[model samples]
Target: MKKLMMICMSLLMVIGLVACDDDTEGMKKVGIIQYAQHPALDQAHDGFIDALKDEGFEEGKNITFDDQNAQGEGSNAETIADKLVNDGNDLIYAIATPSAIAAAQKTTEIPIVISAVTNPEDSKLVKSNEKPGGNVTGVSDLTPVEDQIDLLVKLAPEVKSVAVMYTNAERNSELQYEIAKKALEAKGIKVEAATVSESNQVQQVAESLVGKVDAIYVPTDNMVSESIANVVSVTNEHNMPTIVGEIAMVEKGALATYGINYYDIGYLAGKQAAKILRGEAEPKDMPIEYSSEDKLEMGFNESTAKKLGITIPEELLKEAKIVK
Candidate 1:
């Protein structure tokens, strides 16, 4: 009777092992490649995960996420992209332009949803915004460069000249620079420009602009965003008000900006990922999405304003969201 009981237990163990294997095979995997560790990108990552959760893709159950950060290095992003592609993720979420470009170069089979990328077509990640023509489509965090500049004028009416600071390596930054230069010229604001090839150069570059320009215009450049503290240290000392491309910079110590919510952009991209995972759509056919104009909000740093002795205009203060 004891021998018979042991045999029965062995058969049950084998059945359980088979069941577990089947469950593992059925689990879907998603890989996330974030370009940097800034708050804006961090918010986007969390929003994407929350979106997947809301869509019933519960972690440790039906889905798993292999999230990797490139540590603001392009090579790291390329390596991480290769790993995600090799691991056979059902879908990949890329948080920045570099990460998205890395993943797009890695695989055509895996659907890639990107957030915070300015111009997909310009980046060559997609054939066109209207038709992706490949397995890459998501949300763009393209802030209104003109509107942001106009907001700067309203906040600091004394700004007769402006310095545009950005990292030269970023294609999107270059794109914004061109538009901003034209807009600044159009508005009759003399534009002084500076570029940094590396983050370590940001502080020196910003310092060089001191006393040369009345204000600084920093676009949503990843390197500049990551090294914003360095930029603000110089600006704050000079009481220079820096108008930025996104709210995250304002929160970090820059003066103000009119931009889209990074979380909203990520959530929208997550929804796009869900549709592809559900077989309801393909990325190639999915039109690239953008945050609605209504979603853009003006953000101000009250502490920075007070430190710079720049009085916030009453009407503008009422319209802007003060950073806590």
Candidate 2:
């Protein structure tokens, strides 16, 4: 009789475990990986979470998230992707080009959503933007680089030479550098470029541009964006006027940029994620979205301009967003 009771107790324990497993069957798991910490990327991540909530996937209820930040390391990004995919995450949101590519490389079966990538095709993270042709699709923070350079020219009319600095390892920054170089050259301005592979080199690179160029320009580079304060430190000491690809950089001391709203792009990516989670769409069928042209806006930092001894035109200041 005692042996019989032991068997019944073991069976009851198994039933209890099975019931607990069944209770979680209704919840969805999402894995999010960010390339680094910066205002633009943070805004994108926040927007994505908010949009997911808007789509009825509330945190701590129907959905759970495994969020990881790569801290600007490619190897770390790959490891994070592997853990998220191998651990059976239902979806992945990659917050930058490197993070997106890492997630894409980790699994083809898991639905992967990307945000803040400039050229998805050029990065080879997707087959095409219109139709992903694979398990990766989302939003692009493709700011108008040419228009930004035009605004920079107008902001610094007497600038005859400009230095473009970016992380050499990031193709997104390289693409912007090419555009900035071409635009400045077309206007009879000499263009110089400095490339850094990581954050430690940003100060050296920014210092290299001092006394060599009339102004400095930076694109939406993950590495550079992550270490922009260091760049600003060097540039500010030299009284160099710097233009950037995003408004957040203006707050960090870049003189100006006419850029896209990163938050909106991330929210759009979350919408695509919601559709996939709801069984209404697939990543392969989702077309990547570009930040609308209407969302592009001008920005400038008065403090940085003042330190650089650059005068902002009253008209430009009136229309552009002031970065405090």
Best by TM-score: 1
Sliding window of 10 residues with minimal summed lDDT for model 2: 315-324
Kindly list the per-residue Cα lDDT of model 2 for residues 170-255, writing each as its tens digit.
88888899989999999999998889976788898888787899888888887887778898898877877788889888888788
- Candidate 1 lDDT at 78 equals 99
What TM-scores do the predictions have?
Answer: 0.93, 0.91
Model 2 residue 240 distance off true place after TM-score fit, in angstroms:
1.9
What TM value does model 1 have?
0.93
Q: Which stretches of candidate 2 lie above 4 Å from their native place?
A: 1-23
What ranges in model 1 sit over 4 Å off?
1-22
Candidate 1 lDDT, 87-189, residue by residue in tens: 9999999999999999999999999999999999999999999999999999998889999888888878878899899888889999999999999889889
Tell me which residue pairs clash in candidate 2.
Answer: none
169: Cα error in model 1, Å: 1.0
lDDT of 1 at 110: 95
